[model samples]
Target: MTHPPSAHDAPWWRHAVIYQVYPRSFADATGDGVGDLPGITSRLPYLAGLGVDAVWISPFYRSPMADAGYDVADYRDVDPVFGTLEDADALLQRAHDLGIRVIVDLVPNHTSDEHAWFEQALAAAPGSAERERYVFRDGRGDGSEPPNNWKSIFGGIAWTRVIEPDGTPGQWYLHLFDSKQPDLNWRNPEVVEEFHDILRFWLDRGVDGFRVDVAHSLVKDAALPDWEARAVMAGADDEPVVHGDLGPMWDQEEVHEIYRGWREVLDSYNPEGDPQRDRILCAEAWLPTQERTMAYVRPDEMHQAFNFHYLQAPWRAADQQRIVETSLEAAEAVGAPTTWVLSNHDVVRHASRLGLPVGQPRPNGIAAGDPQPNAVLGLRRARAATAMMLALPGSAYLYNGEELGLPDHTALPAHVRADPAFHRTQGEETGRDGCRVPMPWVAGEPSFGFGAPDDVDTWLPQPLLYGSLSADRQEGVAGSTLELYRTLLRLRREHDLGVGGLEWLTALEGMPLPEGVVAFTNAREDGPVVTVLTNFGEVPVVLPEGREVLVASGRLHRDGDGRRTLHQDCTVWLG
Candidate 1:
């Protein structure tokens, strides 16, 4: 897709560079040991200067914090721990003033057990309208067994039996995630209409768009049949990538129907008179295939879906190339731009992931006694991988601290962990708290300047390594990851890489890339050509003649002929 001559001439989201902010760990302004809205607002200048086009803040709505704000109790109000409605309004105003858009997280699939609606459902008798708003069903045989044999993504059975107000055993409600997060019944008209109103409430508050949480989950199979015999998506090592159905719990066909209505709600805000002011929706879909993932971004539905396929790809040239090709092809067919992401709050940082031995199972949580990744190799590969990611022909998402080359706090004490994944699994599987440690803004300040100097403690302890890698220490330091990102983002926009067409180096007749190299050229119809190459092999590869180097992820070696040689785990942008 060709970019319009000016940002105002096209939808900003089409080629935007978004940054994901995990709030509780971003900054703490209230000195309460937790990151708050005012804290995020205070950091808007840092984001604006970072050159990102928008920020997708994780859920900060009123909640019991059972699942780190994912179990939203009130969709319209900000959690007191974070801030209030006035603080949210101020954040929106300040971010917009800085030319940065805001995309708030929306958890529509479930509501907290403490939510007013859920409380009402608990008090009302079974089969009442209040109970109908959720997936409350009578259990089979003495009402003791779960309604279905569905497993929660967290752990255990997906259904949770609730005790009635009269102290009698009642119906079981579907949770899909943590027990405290009751899944909403989308089939109920009140549930559907309530979300429609929730969308308008935020849109009217001036949010540019929403990052829909569990976009594929609002609707499930009507039958809710047992899934033990159904087909499941397997990993790359598995023989066939995808076959049969995705079971009754995920990627149901009815989800698209729900999103189409949301599109109408967003479109209502963007009349012909204000096309550039269009509101967009992004899906956090973790499907098994490009075909399934692309369905969420169809023209009349959501605008973009997370590319988990790319995020989960092994650090191999062939694998990366295949995913990029398929993703681009699939999105192009549906008139949507592909989204690229390397790190986020839910998984181990890509820096640490790349450092681990190839093909090892990704760890949910790492402690002191566990196998450790190679910090040096991990950061090197991470920088190279990021350069290649930013140069791809679409939007790129940067996690909060990946810019600082931050690795996971693998040795964090178990007692301080808060991720529901950890508690739900009873410590057998560590949770995502390793990667959610608070960012270090200063090298010497308490909590690394996360809050006031006297705020000695944070919600999650910072790793000792954060001292040297702090943003203050990295600033103005040449070759630092932070500086590399600033330069990469600047040139990406300057060359219009996001809106350019991508062609594999091998696709160009007579140009065969090295065996272990992934190379591509991106050029807009009216913009200069830019080439990105990454060396994943052990041997150095000689560069082609007469290409000017714009940026390099690491130091390059020069041969006798003065030609640049890209070393292993190195990436370079040539123009």
Candidate 2:
């Protein structure tokens, strides 16, 4: 029905890029000031034109709107606010028609309290089957304490009292996120069966695959020891005692058992290397160590997971390079491919993170108190980061407005925000809302290029800088960051950037590794091995030797026989 390109023409994973669209703010077609499935369907052509291989839609499933759709009350039906099931079918079909695959989000860790199953269990009598659906325990028998002392990531205690079906007043249940989302008792066989059915419902829906949310939290310690009572005594700050263990037991052998079962099921849907219908299972996990991170990507666990080390690392080439190398090494050791990510819904935008002023009170881009050290070397830094990301040997994920050089804190107010983590950590640390504000489409619109120009207000306020920070305005200007993204993506596909044999070569301090400049070469048998040099500094950096420039941040340079000069932040390609 569609005519983009045959599946065989392009390998499912090779030479392909994924573009993430946050459904709530992509576009508001209904004029209700919120985006929906129809709004996303209407924007299909634009995404296809952008030359991405797939679209990963953040959860649009039915829920109480807690955590922005992650708390699912129903798996088979679409949220009315987003659209009907028919609209979902249409959206998937339209994306496929444009040679773009559609990947939906799946959250199996917990369920909304409003779900019929949870409600039934909440009312069932003690010792009933329904009561077993969640982690229910008898509370403070006579003079006893809670099952465990695990503190909630949001703040205080993780346990909430819920009356038993027997009308007992002292029963409690565990919830990791909110009381609104109660954690499921995976120890129960029926609970596992119900979730497996949930997975199959989507698998049968013609969707390309899924991005599994919080895959590791499904299993917990059955002992349920009160964490605070343990000898570990992690209680050091104003906060409650931290959980004591994070060893193999922390992952629970049962966790691997569950994932291996899911992998068997995914295999039934699409066997390995099946191009026409590939079933991908990417996970979102956060752990402190590399060994812990690997548990999520074993051969039978997740196909890939986002690399967060870089996202949290301090902005420095040495720091970033080590993170990148370590991630790649760990993935290879596990015999699984890696997914490179620089930005996501949960982190500050790279531009804001790179260029924020220190000790300044500037709202928007104003110099508030004093400027924090953001990457003052703007355009060049952006170009270098892009080259580094794209040249890596794996799938690359991109956020919506990153290509347009969209700056953060443009106009998002402190109020009208929804991230609990940000609100919880205010003053001490900020959450990721600054980067999630509405996109600037046209510079002329009073709504700052996001909502309709004639409309009184947009869903998210159109920041005042909308006039200058827009994709439309930058599209007309040569060498704009927006243009650079388009061109670089094209070159990636046309020139085969990371396809064949390639090796990384580094120059140490004593060996002419010019200050703030990094040079490396890719070996190719059929053609000239490409040599790339990047400059993250402000001034032009001189090259080592025998290097010719092909592409720069703002302009392209030529060898002119032997010596090469690269402007700051720009990258030069040579063959």
Candidate 3:
């Protein structure tokens, strides 16, 4: 059967190259050593020049910052650390003027305990309207024990007992993350109505779309059954437990109904005659299978869902190829473009993660006492992997510092680390602070020129190695990671590769390729066909005959017969 058209046939986000800006680290315009909305506005021209079609700003909402702004206190205003509502408006307008769409992060799974509703819940008696908005339960036995055996994703009991204002022990509330962030009761109609209004609030301010955080976690089973430990639920030491039957806490079937309601809100914003103005929703669901993930991107639900399976796949040709095929097929079935992401704010940077032992668990963070990463080998593989991602058939996402080939500061001092996971795991996990360090802009400048004043200290300390990877140092330099990105993005637009269909060249007749290599062609009906190949093995491989070279990750060697040879861990583009 033929695929159906997506929500908007020619929407820009369908095949867009989106750049994610983790606001706290992007730029420090306020001189407070924290990046803000104004700072991001100042850099729109740079993003436009980088050839990205859109920007997804991480949460800048008014927050206590207990979980680095993911624990939002007020959904309508910006945090003091990120600037005011006017600043956010100016940034959105500036981005639109530059032909770049803006997508803001929407955290719907929970709210900061300081939120008015949560505060009211604390003051009100149990079974009151305020308490009904959250998941409040009575403790079993002596009212001191937790209601169930549920463990927090952050490494403790999910339930926290609250003391009544009368100075007696009280009912317990649930927080899947940190205690400061309480899970919302999606079963409450008021919670549903509130978020619906929140959507309209942002869309009215000219936001093109939203990136829904924890999209698979809004709903829970009504019965709140006990979690049964299964082998599939036992994840690796470093990775989060994302798969398996996580009872009542994740991946409930009722979550889709909520997205369908959200889709209606997004559809209402489309002007009668302009499909280009349609607002979109992208889900950050970490489901077990691609088929389940695609369910979030169906026509009446979200516009897209991130393909984490592909991102978490090992750096092997066979594994990568299988994930690509599965992801494409799943998206095609629902008529949604696949979204490929390599790194983001939550995980360790892929550059360093790929350098670790192949079969071992990729840790969320590495401590000073742990084995260090091989920077040289990691950067090379990261560059090659980026080239391959850009040549694929769907939209691609670039994290803030990936263009500079930045490796995680794996040896960050334990005392200075801010990620909640670090404290929750008692420094054993190291947390995601390494990946969230501020971006480097200038060499030899204090804080690497992240702030306006050279002497300003960043919230997170920058390593000495950042000097060599600063954007100012890499700009205009041949073969620099920054230059490579600019070149690839420019080529992608000029050749229409982002909107083209993909075909595996290795499956074609008379194709010459070695094992542990991936080869594919981006084909357009009226444009030139582009071939992309990557060598993941130790040995070199001969390139296809008579193809014009477009670009390559590294220098290509020529044999006596004029055949081009791709070296190990290299990718090349040809037409």
Candidate 4:
């Protein structure tokens, strides 16, 4: 997965702009009020128009609808709710025909409680091979207590005691997530062999790659030692805990061996002798430090890990600058490209997030009664932040609807929420359903054109304000968020910004620039130089001379002398 130094030799993912589609919320072609693979196929044109190089579809595997498909009941088949396996094949073909690669989400850490293996484990006696496939263990103390002090990532105890087939309280199984998802025993030889076959099954179906879900959780401390007693984090996107402070259940050392095996499976596909043809494995590893993050992207392991450090950084000038510098440096150390992202299905959208007063702790979810963010200011900063993110030197990921400046459905009611985090925490946490609402494609249409025009149903309710921000309303509109994204993506490709070299313009020929302005220049070998300037302060500032304005998040103000001034919360690209 090494990215060649020269842009010509680099793998497509090194500079690709990949878009994520949460299938259940992407589109509803079946009119079942839920999205499906066929819906994604029908929307390929929209993605092509959005200018992303690839599409990363979230889990649509056979499941019981617990944790929204993260709990896999079958690895080799598509869930009926998301259409059939045939529909998935059609999506792959259509995306490739449009010059787009498809990266399917792979959940290997755990399986649904109803999965065949788990059911078999329930029927088998304790200490049997069937039960050994999962993390099943005897209860502690009086056989009523959990095996360890660990808490589930969603909430509650990490271990769920299962009733034996003989009708007695039996072994407790580990489920770092919801009780419905039982963690696999990766150390088991049979479990390892099963995942290898799963990888080959999808690769044979022509998927370009996989976004490994919970990539760091496959392996755990063999000792199964009790962790320090601590409260479970409300949501999964909390800031990374340092290695020494981390619990034994996450980011274990043995995980690297598993990925190294998966890498071999990917390399086997490059029969054309071109490393670029090898399928990619992008890890969803929320690790401690930059160095630990880089380890996942080394040549023998994953091609990229989500740059969560950048995603979680505060919307401050100094913090963003430092994160960008450290992210680039850390990835460079391993000869891998940095993968930048703003918002995803797991966290609050950056629009509403950055709109909050600076330095306020990011909430798990924003409900109808929660203090709201200023929509105008939020969209402005979201656009500016996205522009800056695209100008950086690495691959970038765009969650669906982000190009439309969509904010969280902050007013969504608790009754309609389906995220496991929300229910597990007894509604104290708002959960991620707000960020997973069906996208609004057409203005003034039923379900905002998410389904048939007459169909008023959606899996999750939409907000009334979605009408004005629908894709149809923003397309072709000047200075609209959708158009700005199209422009930014276009310029990024034309300037080779994804594979370019970046350096901070800390000072022009040793002269300092304005405070609260983060500026940098990106130049690829044998490519044009593009400068990006973002103003995060309250004041406007003049741009450097001899650079022509290419695009901006907002309108540039003109001073009395006719010089263009970059205003607050604006980001501009100069050529």
Q: CA lDDT, every prediction?
A: 0.86, 0.64, 0.85, 0.87
For every candidate, C-alpha RMSD to the true structure in Å: 2.7, 6.0, 2.4, 2.3
Each model's TM-score? 0.95, 0.85, 0.96, 0.96
lDDT per residue (tens digit) for residues 513-541 in model 1: 66889988887767788888899988687
lDDT of candidate 4? 0.87
Output the worst ten-in-a-row residue range by lDDT, candidate 4: 230-239
Q: Write the per-residue lDDT of candidate 3 for residues 314-387, one digit (tens) a residue.
A: 89999988888888889988988898988998877888987877767767788788888888888888899999
* Order of candidate numbers by lDDT, starting with the best: 4, 1, 3, 2
The numbered model that scores best in TM-score is: 4
Task: List runs of model 1 lying over 4 Å from the truth.
Answer: 1-10, 229-244, 273-275, 452-455, 507-512
lDDT of 2 by residue, 1-575 (tens): 10011122334653357888887767666666666888889878877767777889888888887677878898888888788889999998899899998888888778888889889988886577987888877767551455566655444466788765566665677776666778888889898788678778877877776787766677877877655422211111223323424422135668777777777777689766565566677777665555566777787776677666655554455565676668767766786655677666665566565554322222222122324425345434666677667655556788877787665653345576655544544623244456666677777654554444465455556556546758778875777777777766765565555443335455522456556665655433454556666665554655656544444555644355644556665676664
True-structure lDDT of candidate 2: 0.64
| Residue pairs with backbone atoms closer than 3 Å in model 4 (clashes) | none
Global Cα lDDT for candidate 1? 0.86
Better of 2 and 4 by lDDT: 4
lDDT tens digits, residues 135-247, model 4? Answer: 99888898898888888878888999989999999999999899999999999989998999999999999999999998888888988898764323312444434443567
